[model samples]
Target chain A: MSDAPGVLTHAAVMTGRSLRISRRNLDAMITAMMLPIMLMLIFVYFFGGAIETGTAYDSYVMYVVPGVLLLCAGFGSATTAVAVSEDMKGGIIDRLRSLDVGGAPVLAGHVVASTVRNLVSTTLVFGVALLIGFRPAASLGGWLAVAGVLLAYIVALSWISAAIGLLARTPEAAGGFTFFMSFLPYPSSAFVPVDSMPGWLHGFADHQPITPAIEALRGLLLAQPVGNAPWIALAWAAGILAVAIGLSGVLFRIRTA
Target chain B: MPETMIEAHGLTKSYGKPSDPVRVLDGLGLQVPRGEVFALLGPNGAGKTTTVRILATLTTADSGTARVAGFDVVADRHRVRRAISLTGQFAAVDATQTGEENLRMTARLTGLSRSHAKHRAAELLERFGLTEAARRQVRTYSGGMRRRLDLAAGLVGSPEPGVFFLDEPTTGLDPRSRRELWQVVRDLADGGATVLLTTQYLEEADRLADHIAVLNGGRAVAEGSPETLKARFPGHRLDLVLTGREAYLRLAARAVHHSPGTLTLGLPTDGTAAHARALLDEIDPHRTDVERFSVHSASLDDVFLALTGETAEEAAGETTGETTEPTEEPTHV
Candidate 1:
């Protein structure tokens, strides 16, 4: 299952540290979880019934489900940005640099931790959405497919967040990047129909990366027609992931250099 | 090459904002023999931290070569990192994690087995006298305790004898903790670990390090045992006082001439007490009641001042003097 005991061992150790940190920061995790939960509740109970859709009101919640899950991917970057920035401010990263540990492994641990956190937060959001009125017409196989897409987005976004964190000089700056990322989906097809957006807004909404990502997610969950949007979404996410990973590597090399 | 634990030949560095380039370490050279605590002393911005960073492979030198534990800092960085550990001046402990948890995390990161990490954390917790605070979050730890935990964290999974780079290990420590940390450093050295450190506290270097290097303007101005450098600088500046004005003028002629009102005769000596005897031979001790015959020889502070051309005392009040390493330095290792 594993090629190198060293890599896995290091990853496991980092995972433990990551999890311990996550556990102690339960309040923070809970606070982050609450944002999506509140959005889910507000959209489903109050706005869900009033909003007009050719689709059923209960079904809109399910339609928005994958988009919200995609939103969780943004948190991976958010968490990393805040944590690494704080560590940098406090001189922890400098100390880590002095240690014998590989810089890549240490950074990888943070990214992995961010992915894990996003997944956990996304799961919580999902559980709450289900309670509010989100039902997928797809089979269990389809549900796993939905999850796989969401995980990819999270991994991709987490690296982006790490890059932001590395580039920022302060924790606030790192955290601030998340606010922009979180807002990206709202203007796209995450919460509302791209067709409902204004003519100019619709053009932007339709073409934005989050738009295709939500469309791909929607198709997977609702047993809707799987089209090229999924391919485009995958390409966008992968491209972003590649850029972030490359930039992170460059930054690490620059620092070590 | 007597197992050169740390060897730097003409190391240099420059840093600033991306737009502006400011040189920090310039053609600096140092060697740390195995199992010795080598101390680097300089004023603020003397490039102590920069030198340590280059040696530790945290930053590359602009030119020259460095090796830690016989591994090149550039080509064999990973190997160099594997053979060394560093405890920076600040505690650098994870505030969210408990003391034991921090150690465990470090152990895990360093490739200890799960059970071994747990065991190592437990052992280090006890050894650092942190078992009592094992469960408490690091934010609640006192400065000394937190630094101890940081050192323990650096030691986790580093069971082999290694080089430990300590940057200003004890700057803010109280007398008791300072003494305790000195003992800890002594133990580390005795146990066959090479330690290279930088400090503004000269007395700490005097007591702890076998070799001391004083950095000035990004260069090693003086490098030797503390005693050797001290012996070279104005080791003995004597004060000769006279009973009468006539006698005072007579002695002050031989000493550095001051005003007639000055009772104290400034005597520059080679720090040898023989100069005191020679000066006393000329002046009749019976004829003149010498109020102050105190001898001011070269101290570590004098060496720091003469070599760096800035007083060490000025390092604390203002950041102006130099960018070497003259500031808060509490690094209890």
Candidate 2:
């Protein structure tokens, strides 16, 4: 009999499979990338001038783009919950598990593909933001740092969505659970400054991971003082990733057991 | 003497709380010889799926040990997975992927090289008679095609000298598709693969399996060759064609099946000439109690009902075609 395939080989094969699946479902891809662009347009044209940003709508677009990009990545990552839930419901999961393949590759395929998908949507939104008069004042290193932070945030949130997907009993339930994370940015530093929020909401907005992530992105892209937001954001992303990976492992075992 | 390829000892499984657990398998055991098809025959809630799942290494049993293809299901799970293929009640093929892609992915996952995997996928598509539609997504495939694709996918890991677990593989197919799948299953067994088929139809077990095990209430209530199991019950059955509904109603106490459409009452009996005469004499006191009667030998349907205390009508209803037993001694009344 043939020996079990290596983890990297399994991951590659499964990642190829996931990518093909995503390619086939172009509507989902468009929806993921377009939702953020739509939100950016609405907020910039309708609500940007009223917000107390102390800048013109053109400059406000730049300020809001980071928050919108974070929201885009978070929302895009949540879409993976539907795919993962469907995988759990389908017979293919059991079929693959029955094979002599490493367990990590299955989840790895979804996580990696999800990260890629989020990055694509984030890039599309960034492009759209630029088309609408958004500009950045950061150096090349700052742009790289921004890219690094965005990638880290996407990976961490994708894992969390994957965990929620595995834990949910149905695809609808998974969608419902993961969709709530998109709103997390609204209460944080994504849409408005934490200090400008109402008293009760300010505490949560100031401390949550999304706030630090938004602050880091703002600092990186707008040439603002980042202070310790970059470090805090990295720590939060790492912490969530660890917990999500651990939770997903436990959930897989229980569901399969 | 054939060596055993699959062996399970005292397998037990349960779900829910320890204090108020629901037992699905209780001290169940199975043994199958190499290169033979053994069918686990049972109705719903009979632990057939549970046994298959445990032996396939998809689910673990609470107490027992199961070995498939000479490897322990628990300790050597990887080896067992490598040596076995399971096609569950659901087709399990990716609906969004084309049939060819599905097969190729399975092949690659089974450690076949890229070129080998492609070759294997093409071969399987041709073998399953889906080469024309291999490129189309499986969502467009008919039920039979999907099942064939599923069976093809199961063989990606290889079938020769491998163990196959088919759990109710033909549960919802039409007669034509069901017959075609039965032929495929027979082909698998003839190719030297040890096949463990779980099905609810008695005729499926009788036609496809060399040995049959009747599972009930979390255990094998009876296990033997089809002929041996059939021999355990009464030899013959008395079929009485009634004249009217009233006649069938009167004979309902002694009838195992009362079909209003055919106006026939099936009664269990010994195949002896004397028993036939005695039974007819006892029922003929009313003069018009029965219309016509004939005696025929018992089939596996009778065996399953007798062994598991289940109704034969349920089994007969599930079957697509009639199972005709030979007449040992023709006696009419």
Recovered native contacts, candidate 1: 0.59
True contacts kept of each: 0.59, 0.70
Model 1 C-alpha lDDT per residue in residues A153-212, reported as the tens digit of each score:
888888788787777878898899778887888898788777777888987898888888
lDDT of 1 by residue, B148-265 (tens): 8887877765545678988877778777777877877887888888999898766787788999998876888888997886554544556555667777756765653233454666
CAPRI rating of model 2: medium
Superposed model 2: Cα runs more than 4 Å off: A55-58, B232-238, B241-305, B309-333
Give every collision pair in model 2.
none
lDDT of 2 by residue, B1-333 (tens): 238889999999998999999999999988898998999988788899889889989899999898888889999998788888989887788888999999999999998889989999999899888999999999999899999999999889865767899999998999899999999998888788899999987778889999999888799988888888766655567888877878777887776544656677777786677887788888777667677888755544456556654554454555533333232354554
lDDT per residue, candidate 2, A1-257, as tens digits? 56667989899898888888888888988888888899899988888777776543246787798899998988888878888888888777878888866556888888899898888888889999989998888889899889889999999999999899999999999989987888888998676667787899877888988999998998888888899988899999999999999999899888888
Compute the lDDT of residue B21 as modeled in candidate 1. 82
lDDT of 1 at B301: 49
